[model samples]
Target: MSHPHGDSKRTVWYRTQFSSWMIAVGVVLAIALVVIAAINASYRTVSLVLLIAAAAFLVTGGIKVTVSAHGVTVASALVPFLRRTIPLDRIAHASARWTRPREIGGWGYRWKPGLSAVSLRQGDALWLELVRGTNFVITVDDAQTAADLVNRYLPGPGEGR
Candidate 1:
C-alpha cells in the first residue's frame, strides 16, 4: 500500500491477483491457438474466439479496491462503470475472515440465494456489513489492515455527534 504525498486523508489500495493469472493464461492459450491455426486453416475460427476472450480479459480483468476517508470504492482498471463506491457512513461493520470460492458458487461476481460477493481469489477478505440492502464482500490481499482502516471511520457506540 502506497500513500500519495499531498493527500491528507488516509487511502489504501487493494491489488488483485486473480486477473493477472487470467491474462497470463489467456495469452498462452491464444498463442497456442495461433500455432494450431497455422497448421490447419479450420482452426482460425477458434483462434478468433480465443483472441476475443483474451482481449475481454485484458479489459475487464484487474480489480482494485480503494479505501479512503470518504468511502470504499471497488474499481475495474479498464471500465469505469464497473466501479462500486460505498460511503464510509454506509459501512456498518468491516470484518475479516473469508470462505472459499466454492462456498460462494465460484469467484468473480456471484450471487446465491440472498448473498452476493465480488471476489477474485479464495483467501481472507473484507466482509462489509452495509446499512442498506445486502452485505458486500470482496477478497483482498490484506484483510486485517483493510478492516482496521474501515473500522476507524465508522461511528462509535452511542455517539452520533
Candidate 2:
C-alpha cells in the first residue's frame, strides 16, 4: 500500500521468501532417520536429532521483510516472533544493490562487527546505512522500490544517500 499524507509519503511494502529446498531436504532426512529408528530402537536418539534439524528448517524456512511507517521489520513468515526491526529515524540512507550470501555472511540472520543481514538468496537486496555507520541488508525482490520507500523516511537534506 502507498499513500501520501501531508508533506511525507506513507508506504507499507513487504516481501516474503521461502526456502522450499531446505524444507524438502530436512523432511527427507527426518524420514530417513525415522525409518532407521523403526529398524533399530537404538537409533531413536539419532531420529530425535533429525527431528530437531527438521524443525529448525521449518522455522527458518520463510522470512518476510516489511517497510512501514514505523520502520523496516524482518520476521519469519512462519513464526513472526523471530523478527528484527530497524527504526526509520536511525537510517541515514537506503539503496538497492545485488549481493551474494557470502558477501555479508551466510544466509538467514547474520551479524558481524559493522554489518547485519537477513540474506536469503543471491539477488536484489535493500541496503540500509544506519546513522551509527553500521549497515543492514535484506535480500528481497523489488529492492529498488523498497529502498525508495525507506529513503522517504530518512532524515532531511544533507543526510546523503
Candidate 3:
C-alpha cells in the first residue's frame, strides 16, 4: 500500500512487493522443512523449529512504516511489541540510499553497533541518525517520499544520496 488513509493519527505505507516476497519465502521454506523432516525422524523437531522461525520472519518482514507529526514508526507484524520508533526531535539527520543486507549484518531486525532496521529487501532505504541510540536503516519502496513527508512534519539537517 502506498499510504494508509483512514481515521488514524499517522499515514502508514507497506511495500507490496516485499510483502509478497516474504510470503513466498515463508511457504517455500516451510515446504522444504517438511521434506527434510520426512527424510529422518530425528530431524522432525529441528524442521519444526526452522519452519516456525521462518514463519516468524515472514510475519515480521511485512513492515508498516508510519509517519506522523511527531515521528516515524516502523511497526512490525509478528513482533509488534518491539516496533522501532524514531522521534523527530531525537533525529539529527534523515536520508535515503541504496542499501544491501550484508551491509547491516544480514536482513530482518538487526542491531550492530550504531545501526539497526527491519529490512526486507536490498534496495533504497530510509536512514535516520538519532541523537541517541544507533542509527536506523529501513526498507521502504518510496524512500524519497517518506523522507520528504518526515521533513515536512519536522524539518531538520538531512540529505539523500
What stretches of model 3 exceed 4 Å from their correct place? Answer: 1-21, 34-41, 77-82, 155-161
Best by lDDT: 2
Error of 1 at 107 (Å): 1.9
- How accurate locally, in lDDT, is each candidate? 0.72, 0.83, 0.73
Model 2 Cα lDDT, one tens digit per residue, 1-161 = 45535544456888888878766776787788788888989888878777877766666668898898788998988889989999987888899999999999987678999999887778999999998999999988999988988877776788653
Candidate 1 positional error at 73, Å: 1.0
Report the CA-based lDDT of candidate 3 relative to the real structure: 0.73
Q: How accurate locally is residue 92 in candidate 2, as Cα lDDT from 0 to 100?
A: 83
Q: What is the TM-score of each candidate against the true structure?
A: 0.69, 0.82, 0.71
User: Per-residue lDDT for 70-137 in model 1, tens only?
Assistant: 77887766665678888988888888896687866665666776566766778888888887756778
| Least accurate 10 contiguous residues by lDDT in model 2 | 1-10
State how far residue 89 of model 2 sits from its true place (Å): 2.7
lDDT of 3 by residue, 1-161 (tens): 33545533465444432466676778789888999999988999999889987776677667777666668888766555657777777776678888888987777778788888767878888888786856888877877767766656565345421
Give the residue spans of candidate 2 off by over 4 A: 3-9, 34-39, 158-161
Error of 1 at 97 (Å): 1.2
Report the lDDT of model 3 for residue 43: 97
Error of 1 at 82 (Å): 2.8
Alpha-carbon shift of residue 17 in model 3 (angstroms): 5.5
